[model samples]
Target: MKKSLIALAVLAASGASFAQSSVQIDGIMDAGFQSIDYKGNKVNGIGNNGSATSQINFRGTEDLGGGLKANFRVETDWNTVSNKGNTGSASTPVVAGNETVAAASTFGNGEIRAGLAGGFGAIDAGVVNYNTLGTYLTGQPFGTAIGSGFRTFYVNDAQSTSQVRSDNSVKYTSPSFNGFNASLYYAAKQTKAVDTANTVTNSVTTAYGVKQTSFGGLGAYDMQGTTEVGVNYANGPLAASFSSLKQDFKDVGTGTTDQTVNTLGANYAFGDAKLFGLYQTNKTNTSSVNNKAFSISGTYTMGAVVLMAQAGELKNDVNSTKSKLVALGADYNLSKRTAVYFRAESIDDKAGTVQAALTPATIKGADTKFARTAIGIRHAF
Candidate 1:
């Protein structure tokens, strides 16, 4: 009788454990129509991610006694127009211009991670989204949407710089203390490809004599280790953030170099209006390639509508030229989970033929200037 009771007790405990675990499904659906005019040439099409990146997310968590918990997330992104899964490679920089070169479909390409959480905060390992200067993190009025102007001035992953999502990475987030918290991340080293003669080598050399190999559109495929650190503080109506990333690189033979980027941003709310400001600096060590960017944005909320405007500039010290961006837009909330928006943005760049945000195939010449107007709808669940 005692043995039978012991078996029953074990089964009861197992059922209780299972009851403590939970799983859910959630995601965003956003799509829009865009009319782009470049150097007097116009084109119209449907675009994805106008207001927010559309994605499907599956999340699960389990209580592990005490104050600990285990969790995992699987997310996948897709282009609404093509109905193809996004591989999250659109952020990788190229020598020509921002191009759509990812595979037609990929699974779990967005922020897949598994980790634990407790009083110490959380630690996760996987392909992690580590972009600290992105629109959401910086409190950009348009949230990196069509006319945010954030992308024109600052790029999270630009050839020798940082990446939006660091693969093969481990990240640790600290528990909040007095409205302040921090994150530390590290990505393992990767094998780099050496340049061979006669090969279509699309490389860039900083003034300091460092060269980066971009085997024709495969810039992020091979690289060294990467490190990123960031901190954020939120209290009442004021919020601030700062982040720094260092990426190491290697060249043919035994030469190595590194790139670093630093960003600082803050936002403040005043009644029905809010203001945001951001400053960033990037440098390729020893190359004397110093780039600086800054932007200021503001938004006013009235009833169910929010209006946004932003202006920014990118000073490319390497080429002794500057690129400018101006954006205006508004979002109208249809409900708590749905929104309709419109954006009009323009960018002017004469320094480099390749603008990271514009499609190279669509752009005409080295000196590029363009304007885009878009209307979109978003739904979240």
Candidate 2:
């Protein structure tokens, strides 16, 4: 009887442990206000404009025994101001309203993961996030308020029709060793194929002009795919990262079949200050030839004040045009989770030339020159 009781106790303990390994919920909530000026017009916009953007993330994991585990996450954006109809809204809606579930596994090495995570390596991917190449080449954080002034939809014929995110994607990550690691990823196309009409001729006519006949074209749904590879390294106070991304669209009518981008960046930190720089190039099969960008930024922290400055240039070879931006900002940290920030930026596009494609948002004033000044508070929980 005692042995049987001991066996039962073990079984209960195992059950309890299994239950403990089930799932957990955690997330962060961020919200803020913002305003901008366009050609002397003060346009005000608010809510989750910066790092304090609103979001809710829920993740769960299961221990599969033998150094293997299964994990999943369902993350979405949450507007603290209004819980309106659903978890998403028209302005700052959730990235993938009903499709934010990511399931993957981790082998014994904790560093290797396979599933629906962000892109491989240093790139982050999801319904709301940009591809690794796009993220790096854009040189902007997930939701940075700055850098939007010069944003463009297509560079060198490469089009970002949809916000960076891929559905039904599989990704893999390698463990970082000595402050270095690599990643590779592939995204599947979830689109359908269609048929079109075409004209063809069998052979040249003997005496009369060659004749052509119309026939139904045999077109299939061209499977689209995206491939991304990146490497990141961080040692001591210095860090660097690079990535390459290729986006392919098949069966689309006469559009560029592929878009390729390359990005490289490095940063160095010195006690209370840090300096960083980035470079990017975009190429496509269309006439837009090549688009290039470069930027440098620095930040210094002293007591309650953190000062920042950044300068960047974007160039489009086809247009023979260039655009430049300079910005300065300051932040006063009230606490670890809260801070007040103010920033101002100046932009210039060569006269009569289209602005560089790299700028995220347009400049606020006439002659492609303007500034943004904001004083806002941010908090995270």
Candidate 3:
């Protein structure tokens, strides 16, 4: 009889512990039709991620004692049109000169993190999104979607190396204190190389933006990883943020050069309208060139419709190069989790290299200009 009683007690304790944990599944599905005119090469297609990246997410949390919690999140990028993963490039390739210009792939694990949280803050380790891309997501009216000014410019050189998504990373986010918080992120060294026998790997280029050829017969290369810091403030109708990111690149024979970027962003809400602004500067020790970019955007909401407009400029100070953009769009909410969106955008690059958001291609030494139009539906759950 005592054994039966003890078994019953144990089962009850297990049930109670299980009740303290919960898991949820959620995702977004977005698709659209887009027509892009890349100065003479025109293309139209059914597109994915026209308004938002389609993704599925699994998130869970377990409440522990002493005001603590254990949390985890896993996200995967999905392509609604193809029923496969995101291809991370234009479905139709653009031809510029004799080269086929294809956008670099932006597909990743999204984010997979597990960590503990308490009154002090939360710490997680895994593949994570760095805070330096605040303008791409937070400070822009389009939020990295089609027609986003920053996405059109920053996708090329600003974040080509490693400021967006990082692997083998650890991050800490402080608890909000009176509308202010801070974050720190670090990623360990990521290395890739050919065998020592193949000392001359030709013009092998690394993710850290370096090319080398058997420098002193080393036949090895590595990225020194990244360190980033961010601070943000949000209260009432105002939100502002600042971030600094540094990445080191090392080649077998070329030594190392440090690349750094600093960004500042802010947004203010005025009744039914909000105004956003962002400014960023990037530089590398290997080159004497410096790049700067700034954008201003605004949004107005009325009933079930939201209208947005944005303008931005990117400049290379050393070469007197400039790229300009203007975008206008609107979204009509069909329901709480469903909406239809429309966008029209234009970009002009005379002597610069700034690709459009949907069509990531640019002509060199020639007038690279394009106009894009898109209409899509987005559903979330």
Q: What is the C-alpha lDDT profile of model 1 across 154-247, one tens digit per residue? A: 6664342233666567899999999999999887654444432333336843331122233232344344567889898889999988888776
lDDT score of residue 13 within candidate 3 = 72
Candidate order by decreasing lDDT: 1, 3, 2
Tens-digit lDDT string for candidate 3 (260-360): 77888899999999999888777888765477888899999999999999898889776888888889999999998899999888888643545343444
Clashes of each: 2, 13, 0
Best by TM-score: 1
Quote each prediction's TM-score: 0.81, 0.67, 0.80
By lDDT, the best candidate is: 1
Between candidates 1 and 3, the lDDT winner:
1
lDDT by residue (tens digit), candidate 2, 7-126 = 333346676554535444444454446565554546666644344334444455554555455555555545554545233222211111111222211111011122332222233233
lDDT of each: 0.69, 0.51, 0.68
lDDT of 2 at 71: 58
- Model 3 weakest lDDT span, ten residues long: 93-102
Q: What is the lDDT of residue 228 in candidate 2?
A: 73
Pairs clashing within candidate 3 = none
Error of 1 at 166 (Å): 1.1
